[model samples]
Target: MVLKIALIGAGLIGREHAKLISSNPRVQLEAVADISEAGKVLADEYGTRYFFDVREMLDATKPDGVIIALPNAFHAEAAMACIERGIPSLVEKPVADTLEAAMQLTEAVERKGVPVLVGHQRRHSPDIAKARQLMNEGALGRLVAVNAMWLTDKPTNYFDAAWRRQPGGGPLLINLIHDIDCLRFICGEIESVMAFSSNEVRSFEVEDTASISVKFTNGALGTLLMSDTAVSPYNWDTAAGQALYFPHQPENTYVFAGTKASLALPLMDFWRHENENSHWQHPLLRQHITLDGSRAYENQLHHFLDVIEGKAEPIVSVRDGMLTLATILAITKAGKEGRIINVADMLG
Candidate 1:
């Protein structure tokens, strides 16, 4: 059966979702709602109906499932509308603009018993999924420490949007949140964070660079360096070649160092002693973990369809998305306050 899927917002990520819907054989692009000229153009291009008002579109189409790709501020409201009408939706990440908003949406979703998937897309990637599974199975062993880097140079005009220069729109929330969520998913909850951020490079209200330290509840530690002003391809988007719009750079962007061995992602290299009794003096062996040549966005679309059909639950639920948001928010706060911040405090 070809399920019908509607899209709210036709912006960058929304456009990508539209393309996915158009190509997937299991779903039809029911309609699109966007308050922009680009939205209409996109709808016309895809040969789908277009609406300026969200409710009007929802009422007119009554799609089996919806994809909420609206801006950060509108995510909760858009998802709530779907929930009220008993429609399942895939909300683009961050879940909502603020903690309060996320909490409200979570309550509404739970009360309505409607399934809502958070678009972290990385969770759907086979390598990341396998990494989490292996970690759970102690493949990395003891999960001691992790190091990650997301360094890339964004075109100066990328900040032409006012929000991109403000606090909520920086790389911390916009980019590193994925890494944080991946970490949480692979390891465990983050207990506390200490960070330092700088906007000196761009001199914008939002930071262009940040260094963060986190302690995981499982006694593991992590360090992450992020900079939008740097020129490099050390980010997962390019390294893993899974991002829709990024050119594949093919490098290891994340490293998980455990007591028994260390794993580097995107490269999928596992390094440890040749045998169980070997120590640090022994030569290490590198084994490549093979992955299915599947794509993240495609897998995510199939998962959403399964969610709509009650065949599966969301891999990244609304609450889980909110927690990831809280952790990043804590990092942002820690960066600004120059202190160690507890992730739990962000909830309060």
Candidate 2:
């Protein structure tokens, strides 16, 4: 049986989801909802119906599942609507704008006993999944420290939107959140964070650069550097060749150091001592790990279908997404307050 899917919002990411849905033979793009004319245009192009009101579209199409790709602030409300109707949904990342709203949506899903998937597409990447497996298997040997970077030069035209210069609009929230989620997925939960941010480059209300220090619950230390003003190619999206929009630069953007070995991400270059001795006399050997390629968004759609069909559980649940958001928020708070912020305190 083909699953009918309704898409909420017709923005860039929403349209991408619509394209993926249309490409999947097992799913039908039944209807789309958006406040802009793009919704109708996308619907007409895809041979589907369109509505300005989400509720009206949901009622008219009665799709088996929905993909919520609305703005961050509208996530909880639209997701709650679907949960209330027992319609499974795959909500885009950062779950909601605020912690309280995210909690409310999660509670509603629990109370209604409906399935919801959080869209952290990196978890579906084969390289990331393999790294996670190796980490869990102790291949890295008790991870000690990690270093990550998300440095890129976003064109000035990208910030033409008013909100892009506002307080909540910056590389920390817009880009770094993905890396934070991937770190949390591969490493353990972050216990605390301290950070410093600057807007010296663009002088916008949002920061253009940030340096963060994090402590994991499992006694691991991590350092992260992010900048939207840097003209570099040290980001997961570009380095890993995930999307077509960016030029693929095969460089390592993350480093995980452990007692036994150190691993560089995306490149998957493993370094270890050739001998059992931990002395400076031994030379370290480098081993390259290769993984098959797959489109993360397409894999995410398949997982969402499995979740709707009850064949698989959500890879990134509502609670997990909320924690990732809280972690990023904690970093932002730490940068502003010039002190350490506990992840648990933010949740409370």
Candidate 3:
């Protein structure tokens, strides 16, 4: 039984999802909506119908599922539209720009009782899944601090795209939201946040770098460092006008510290040991875990279909999206105000 899928937005990530869904034997790319010529090109490449307006596509194709891969600011409107029509949708991350918007989108999903999953692809990584399983099984002992770093440089052409340089469209919102979701997925719910953010590079309207500390409800503290102005060997040259490649940084890395052990995820590498004793040992793990290099996005799509078919529960729930956004905003507020901020209160 092939699930007819409608893709709303044909941007970089949208094309990636389209490739995965079209390749799946259990899924069929039925229709796509994007105002850009790139969207039409992607639809044609996947042998699917294309529409310039998403609402029109939703009405015409009436697909079993929809992938809302529009920009961060547009997520809420697109997702609310899907759930209101009783169509299951998997939206790309940050869910929405603000907590209020996120709550609205989530509430629609709840009132309509439709399967709407946020795209936090890291939850689907084989290594990430295994790490979470191990952690759950007490391999990591008590969960402690989660330190995540995202550093890179973008080309001037990156801001050439209109929306990316606008307010609410910065590294903290546009990119770190994925890291924020991953931290929430692995560590725990954030209780409060303290942040410091500034535009140190590109002289754009949006912030380019940030340093945030989080207090999780589980009593675990986390620090996230995000910047779009670091040039390193591991960098994949993601600057706009460059060759298209992976959606994330080539040298993706994450560190999770617990009472018993600590783990590191650097690109395809995963490392863990007993406490801080072996911190410097066993540096090299492997090249990459097998089984579909795009597992994160693929699994996100698969899980959405499962919920629509009543076969499984959502991987990332609506509450998760709301809490994560609240945490992020709390961080931004703290950074701007130069003080610690309570995430829960901010959400309320």
Evaluated with lDDT, which candidate comes out highest?
A: 1
Off-target runs (Cα >4 Å) in candidate 2 are: none
* TM-score for predicted model 3 compared with the true structure: 0.86
Which candidate achieves the best TM-score against the true structure?
Answer: 1
1 or 2, greater by lDDT = 1
Write candidate 2's Cα lDDT for 1-348 as tens digits.
999999998988998998899889999999999999999999999999989999988888889999998877788899998987889999988788888998898788777789889988999988788889889999889999999999989888898867678866677877899899999999989999999999999999989999999999999999999999998989998999886368888899999998888899899999988776764677889999888778788889999999999999899999899899899999999999999999999988
**Which residue ranges in model 1 land beyond 4 Å of their true spot?**
none
Model 3 misplacement above 4 A: 233-244, 247-252, 267-294
Model 3 score (lDDT) = 0.76
Q: How many pairs collide in each candidate, listed in order? A: 0, 0, 0
**Candidate rank order under lDDT:** 1, 2, 3
TM-score ranking, best first: 1, 2, 3
The deviation in Å at residue 135 for candidate 2 is: 0.6
lDDT tens digits, residue span 153-221, model 3: 777887877888887777777778777877777676778888888886777787888888888888888
